[model samples]
Target: MNVHTPALAKAHRFDEPTSVFARDVIHDLSRAPKRLSPKYFYDATGSELFEQITVLPEYYPTRTELSILRNRSRAISSIVPDGAALVEFGAGSTTKVRLLLGECRLGAYVPVDISGEFLNAQAQALRADYPGLAIHPVTADFTAAFELPEAVRDMPKVGFFPGSTLGNFEPGEACKFLKSARTILGKGARMVIGVDLEKDERTLYDAYNDTAGVTARFNLNVLHRINRELGGDFDVGAFIHRAVYNRDRHRIEMHLISKKALTAEVLGQKFSFRPGESIHTENSYKYSIDRFALLARVSGWSLLQSWTDEAGLFSVHALEASD
Candidate 1:
């Protein structure tokens, strides 16, 4: 499959200091031993690639979470009470979202993401599927608290943050994220967040560094993106994907390792990489129930309910603020 790299020459047109800072940070981290933020992993192409990854046999998070949402959607819908606006962070293809919308009654629907193009398209598709559901698509990075679009300002909210995507953030950041969402939502809002439980290292590693080579291409695809957008030179073939469990951190890290010595230029600067040194691309943190509760408490969110797969490999938690 061909992945198109967005020509960000025009990225300068809408340049914000934050975007520039992010761009530069990524450039510096692309060098050996450097690390890329997980947030950068989702340009349009990367986001689409991830949607494909979710369906792979090796990836069970999608199926497990969907089952939970399906089995519990009616019960969860009851918590909405006087009609709730359904807002999904990192909505992606929103495949599982359909099951919830079908089973639970919603007042409206909102999808928030950094990819305007992809977000709008999915929003349109959802609108067609659920004609009764008002669709509000907000194109912003909701990793931090962000203002909801005016269309959704007055609605009581039900946040759907499925797909253990929450694991991408460091524990502290995840807590802060929950707190921010609460402040935005006020007292009445409820959240259903997917949390991947601690699993064997072999299982975790296989998920990120898939044997099919798709994950590898996805990792190095960032370099191809930089080459296209930032005028950088990266030998895509020189890099290999690497993933491992950091037991202490309770997370899996994805990296792009240089297969041989190579140098690349970006934005008029050059970076060198030695064979085997890697650029960290993303982290997926696994949490034990005990550790997770502490995180929820710090974020001012109390765990209301937790659902687990038969093997306990994943969790889908119902969370709300304690009155």
Candidate 2:
């Protein structure tokens, strides 16, 4: 397998950022109730921290999802047409996809992610392991519209969006994304996605608020990235990390609370944080199977089949495009 790490000279033509990181930081921080897009949390350091988070005993999503994929991969692969291109959204580490790749004779593999360097490195390692497989790594925000390489354009596409990452999006945004994917993959294409099921409050809370503090670091690393890339002065220690289940919203919300009244500078602009004010960083939504199936229907996918662990803590659904 030949590994292609094409120069990102034209990356900006696709979904690459056109504005400075500072601009987004300033705009979001200046909002009434400040919030940041979770996409920013995947810079090299943040990505590493998150990888650590997945392994911590308190974080069950990764291990549980892996178990489901491992046991069901053969059945999962059976539905995927031979020679179908496997396109994964937010392909971090490319670990879970390995299960399916081992079972399926795919025409090509496309892993889309925002972290270019990380994505390339993982893709190269995969190339060495799967020599016969075609590996095309596209470093772009999977949430935005981007073109698939011409190599996979003719092949039937099977989208793999595991890890319940879809839970990060608001329902409307998720719907829009599903629509965009339908356009990209065309009719009859299938999408296999992991969905975190709505469980007990304590279970959900512990998953995000890990005992290891890895998740906390993962959340604060956003501020660290701002300090490094945007020349912001942030006293990382001045903020307390928090993760709470919002029962009404059916999601876990992560925030950084200001320990004291303070002012921070970014891009030469000052923003003030009152004591106890929180900058909302991320939200991970959990869903019931019925709720998700309803979402899939409205989003243009027919829920073909779903597999769950014995405990029903998580689920993976195989959905076919209705159009």
Candidate 3:
């Protein structure tokens, strides 16, 4: 469905193929332990697989966070000033943002994502539903620097970063990202972030290793993406999905282990993997409420308020940028 009631939303591309994806793939695969950025796991196929993962019975973060949003949307909207620009980072299906849009009278809505086509389609759907809302979709890596649309520049900006995606980054990188957001959104801007709380090892393990194997497919799809986009010769079947809870690190680690010794070539470089060798793919760090608050403080944000589900499996915190 294409809706042009509030003007056609324009998409801006900042992640050039030769510069970002290809370069990062070569560099990351060349590393000692061998790793790929989680950001790469969001191609069209990967993105669709992830949406499936969120609904799996074992995946509690999605539903738990959604409950908090649905129940507290008014309380959440109260903090955001009327006519403020809503800038969402890593905007995926645009599902969660719809809850905010229902209550907040946003001046403009900007959804930033790397998957341009998928993002544009979601934005168009949103436009049809909210005809009066100004929707500006930016197709760019939210991690890297990118400019907001000129139209939203003068409007007060409120950042929305849900889905516990902050857990993907290590503490240091997460801090850097928060600081960057502070600069981009400017002072007085507030950010609402979803964070997965530290929970039982069993729960964490089950969440990543769903019984339906959707998470496994989502993990393996990364290799398919590498082969399809970077010209990598990967025997996708040769790798098995593995997720383990790292107690000392307080995180769940997702890896793809080689089922047998094999060699794969990408970007004209061949790499050999020993039997059982694994490429670290993703990490989801669980944080306590206090721990995350400390992180926000260090990153130049003061916590305004936080909401959690009855089980406390997930949390959504509103943080105001400190001057």
Candidate 4:
């Protein structure tokens, strides 16, 4: 796959930030299934809401993944070559990357995220904490192929994809993402990824359905974004957050259910929803160790090592690009 450069992205009409948001929202809401891309869930408000979700008592993935990272920092850092560039995909917050920065020897840090506002603010904060480290922030959808900064092009690259963000993609897309990442990072590159593990049904449900309603706000923030950016008039309060685990798929599905029959307009187009109708928002797929290992192998990566918490709630893996 070719890298999507900033110039190339601007040349396409659909690539315009507001145009894409308006187009996708109208097209998706018109469809029978009525679904939206989870990528839209990262405007400044959405990003802030998600950070809150991570700390909620019902959420376990963040804490569990952090524990694994803390316990295995030495082994994880060993894979990084000195003077290497760490490129993080969908890097919303600096919380997890801080651990790696403290432990690893690196030349620069590149955070690629869709939310430019949040990304810049975090980059600014990082600069204050790590004065010597070079920080490059790229504002683009990480799901699509995107070029790294020219400054870091010749440096050895290590991909950091934490927060189980890989789970947000469908299985096939996840594999495609690994392949795309391999292409972006180039040969001899290494990746450290975090994956949520299959666990009790209740645990999966609780994580997205937090009692404090932070996750709920995070889910609804997409609609809020549509309103703010695309001149949409959605009754954000008319929808309720719903999360359920699909056993066969081994993923938690988050949806916004309509409280009543309602019509919403976006970009001068109207879409109607029936009572109980849902707009599917996000999916968090839990992976077994063997399954994720196979995913990496087929996507041109070799799983070098994996670490898990004591209860096996989450996993962190070290991967090497394979020829």
Which residue pairs clash within candidate 4? none
Poorest stretch of ten by lDDT in candidate 1: 1-10
Candidate achieving higher lDDT, 2 or 4: 4
Candidate 2 regions with alpha-carbon error over 4 angstroms: 1-20
Q: Write the per-residue lDDT of candidate 3 for residues 291-320, one digit (tens) a residue.
A: 999999999999999999999899999999
- Candidate 1 lDDT at 58 equals 82
Q: Which candidate number would show the highest lDDT if scored against the true structure?
A: 4
What lDDT score belongs to each candidate, Candidate 1 first? Answer: 0.77, 0.87, 0.89, 0.90
Model 3, residue 181: distance off in Å is 0.6
TM-score of each: 0.91, 0.94, 0.94, 0.94
Q: For model 3, name the residue pairs that clash.
A: none
Residue range 1-323, candidate 2, lDDT tens digits:
00111222133232335243445666788788998889999988888888898888988889999999999999888878999998998988878999998899999999998888899989999999999999999988888888999999899989989997899999999898888888788778999999999999998888888887889899999999888766679999999899999999999999999999999886556788999999999899999999999999999999989999999899999999996
User: What is the lDDT ranking, best to worst?
Assistant: 4, 3, 2, 1
Q: Report model 1's TM-score to 2 decimal places.
A: 0.91
Comparing candidate 2 with candidate 3, which one achieves the higher TM-score?
A: 3
Per-residue lDDT tens digits for candidate 1, residues 1-323, read 00111234234452553345336555556544687766656777888888878877788788887787787777766666455788888778878788777777677788888777889988898888888888888877788668876777788888888888778887778888888888877777888888899988888877886777777777777787777655667888888888888998888888888889888765544677888888887888898988888898888888888878788888888888766
Clashes of 3: 0
Instruction: Tell me which of candidates 1 and 2 scores higher on TM-score.
Output: 2
lDDT of 4 by residue, 1-323 (tens): 11232333245344477666666676678778889999999989999998998888889989999998888888899999999999999998898899889998899999999999999999999999999999999999898899999999999999999998999999999999999999999999999999999999988888888888889889998998888776679999999999999999989999999999999976556788999999998898999999999999999999999999999999999999997
Residue 269 lDDT in model 2? 67
- Clashing residue pairs in all predictions, respectively, total 0, 0, 0, 0
Of the two candidates 3 and 4, the one with more favorable lDDT, higher being better, is 4
